[model samples]
Target: MATGLLTSEQAEQIVTTCRTAIGDSLRSVTYFTRDDYEQVYLRNDLERDADLSTFIGHEWRGFKTAQTAYEGSELGDYNYTIRVFDNGFLIRVTNESEGVFATTDGLTVKDFEEVATALNSFLGDREVR
Candidate 1:
């Protein structure tokens, strides 16, 4: 397959893999189809403050408002935001309460792998979607 060009079947497979990996650590995961983009969004709860820094440091690259592509933080009682791109397949982490933390380059399989790795590391488990 070409980088970033996943057939519907491939995308479904990826999502299934993510869901299996994260299991209960994930509170919710959804796939959205927009006019020009397809996305996978995930959210999890925050049990401790340390979880905040640890998760961010491990999963996200850094904060970048220019991209506004990915953002994550504590929002109310939950900490969430794992956004995967449709066209580029880049991933972004955002804290709902805080802001954008990190984002990948584009929608290549390599980028998907990176996002999957970060999600596994941050969540301390594997999730397919």
Candidate 2:
């Protein structure tokens, strides 16, 4: 028997969508500027004892990996880190599992908005159990 799996493009689309949704919320809560790629960093400011997963959601496993290419630390029950890129954006999100991490290159603010809107629409149209 064969199981269904998401294609790379599909997976990327999902990640982009999720990021946009979170990004919009972040923007409303803070002030920041975007670089040439329209990328902005969202920092985590929760108390040390707070649950990180509540902020980043359950899908954080995608960015966390065993390779240790990036340095990370644990705060309470969650592992967290700062994601800094050459594009001048520094996002601090929780890292708990390993999956997929999207690159800031080739992604614009407009694209991020579109992805977020699409994800919101998709979820709204679906039935969650």
Which numbered prediction scores highest in TM-score against the true structure? 2
Please report, in order, the local distance difference test score of every candidate based on alpha carbons: 0.37, 0.34
Residue-wise C-alpha lDDT for candidate 1, range 17-120, written one tens digit per residue: 55554433333322221111223333344222223334344443343342344334333322333456452222433332222222332334544455456543
lDDT of 2 by residue, 1-129 (tens): 011233345444554554664453332111111110111122354223423333333224333442254445452333323344564322333212122222333345555445435644543443322
- The lowest-lDDT stretch of 10 consecutive residues in candidate 1 is 29-38
Instruction: Kindly provide the TM-score of model 1 when superposed on the true structure, using C-alpha atoms.
Output: 0.25
Shift of residue 82 alpha carbon in model 1, Å: 6.9
The TM-score that candidate 2 achieves is: 0.27
Per the 3 Å backbone cut-off, how many clashing residue pairs does candidate 2 have? Answer: 3
